[model samples]
Target: MRETAYWLINIACAIVILVLLGVHMGVMHLDAILARLVGTVPEPLAWENMVNRGKSTTQVVLYIVLLGTALFHGFYGLRTMLLEFFSSDRAARVITAGCVTAGGVLFVTGTAVTVVFALNGAG
Candidate 1:
């Protein structure tokens, strides 16, 4: 049950991240730039307007979620692979646990950076 839940969550987060990246790129490049070129109103990129009007909040949250989920999934899955290849008669689970801990630390740091930007209204 728990493992299935994790897999489902991993897949969901990957899909969300992929969609968010696509939408963000499309807006910044296709929509926003085209709007500017056609409208020709003297203004900056107007990212603030993009955020205020467009679905910027979802993009920001999705970015963090994507990073966290990918880190956890990739590192833990890699650790599992390593366990299958190597390890003594024991210590397999221990090593995987260590990887999980390390991945958790990395994800926390990454998430903290994302939080700083989100809170400061950068992203």
Candidate 2:
């Protein structure tokens, strides 16, 4: 039952990652296409545009969410693979602990940076 729940959560995280990463790519990498289609700014990565986005609460929240979701999805996937390869209860425990700890640290750090950037208005 516990494993099942974890698997389900992992799957959900993957879906969230796909959506968030797609948005990130479109906004940061497809500036030309978006500008042509919707008359957006020609350079999404321009300093002014970046500062604007960094100052936006919505963008900050989305960035945090994306960071967390990506970390959870990646760490869970890595844990699954390590467990399968090791196939021991002790290995399972160690792998799970390591992944959880690393993921938590990364999430906290990323969230802190995002919040700080937002507060500083990307200046």
lDDT of the candidates, in the order given? 0.67, 0.87
Q: Put down candidate 2 lDDT per residue, 46-120, tens digits, no spaces.
A: 888888898899999898988888898899889988988998998999999999999999999899988998888
Worst 10 residues of 2 by lDDT: 37-46
Where does model 2 exceed 4 Å of error?
none
Per-residue error (Å), model 2, residue 59: 0.7
lDDT of 2 at 83: 86
lDDT of 1 by residue, 1-123 (tens): 965876776677677767766766655557757576676432335767644432456756766777776786677577667877777646776776788798889888887876666666554
Clashes of 1: 0
For model 2, what is the C-alpha lDDT against the true structure?
0.87
State residue 10's C-alpha deviation in candidate 2, in Å. Answer: 1.2
> In order, what is each prediction's RMSD in angstroms?
5.0, 1.5
Q: Model 1: how far is 17 from its true place, Å?
A: 3.7
- lDDT of residue 119 for candidate 2: 86
